[model samples]
Target: MITHIQGRLVEKNPTDVVIDCNGVGYLLNISLHTFSQIPDEESLKLFAYLIVREDSHTLYGFSSVAEREIFKLLISVNGIGASTARTMLSSITPQQVKEAIAHEDVALIQSIKGIGAKTAARVILDLKDKVLKVYDLDENEVSVNKNNTNKDEALSALEVLGFSKKQSERVLDKLLSEQPDANVETLIKDALKKL
Candidate 1:
């Protein structure tokens, strides 16, 4: 298994980035959070998870070890896939997810695009205790109360699709900064480019 990749960030896309390691270029699908932290034309290092299927082999990258751990927990759910787990991280921070699970807030999880009430409940039931134990963070510390959900609702939508909040916010900010009234889908597309 490939534990991590370190090299020049030659290219970046919404769901992936290509890192040039010596003469070889490694393409890694990464979360929006990790995407935002990456700088163009610079050497980068990402903690990684290798997913092998009967038909394909893919590498998923994370900004931190903690985020990678969260991804593992998310994929362990019966119906969750890597894409869904990535979406969950894009919508909510690892800290927010940990807190939501600790408090068993199924509503928060359900709010994400592909997640339903039943799946949301399952996420809380199966991993709440485990996440709490792993992160050593209280529910209050990770609460979603501070976010401006009204302004962030569009971003919340993109995040569910696996674009990080930072990436979403930056793209949205720029779109609005110029047009000042771009619609949801336009903002999403614009933000996708930066991601």
Candidate 2:
């Protein structure tokens, strides 16, 4: 039930951070996006979801409300867990997640670690209508129409997996860059080689 924590950052790692709040130190699991934005020398206030199980308790923190909401929705799917949801979120922006569901792009979901084709299809089938209901498609939204936005999404997914953006862009550009016509599978294979 802990909604948030505000305190000095006592420690940090790839997946978690320790915050000193009123003399108590709280450990919170966070996404890389949150980690990249947090300043190492300053205190931080993070929105958190406290999860308790038979053997342990964990706190997951998010940098934005949209990300947290998306996480909640993701975990509500029948077979998805918090770790899967976190990995999905880490691999794509919240907006991209919403869009994938909206577009029913099972291949994009399957590109992430731990999601098989069947599970990815289930996710698309289960959440498609629901996600479209809440997503606000703006007129100026940068349409991810790189011939195959799904492959572009895979590149974005690699970036979320900790590859540098420059590297990802370069790879994607190389694979899809030169073509009167290039298929998604070919681009994906080429991109993976770059990785």
Q: What is the lDDT of residue 71 in candidate 1?
A: 93
When summed lDDT is taken over every stretch of 10 residues in candidate 2, the lowest stretch is 137-146
**How far off is residue 189 in model 1, in Å?**
42
Model 1 pairs whose backbones collide: 32-164
**Shift of residue 45 alpha carbon in model 1, Å:** 0.6
What is the C-alpha lDDT profile of model 1 across 7-126, one tens digit per residue? 988888978988898989988888887777676658899899999999999999998998999999999999999999999988888877877777666657877889986898788889
Model 2 compared with the native: what TM-score? 0.69
**Model 2 lDDT tens row, 141-181:** 42344354555566657766788767876777676667525
Q: Scored by CA lDDT, what does every candidate get?
A: 0.79, 0.77
User: TM-score of each candidate?
Assistant: 0.69, 0.69
Off by over 4 Å in 2: 137-195
Reference-based TM-score, model 1: 0.69
Please name the candidate that would achieve the greatest lDDT relative to the true structure.
Answer: 1
Clashing pairs in 2: none
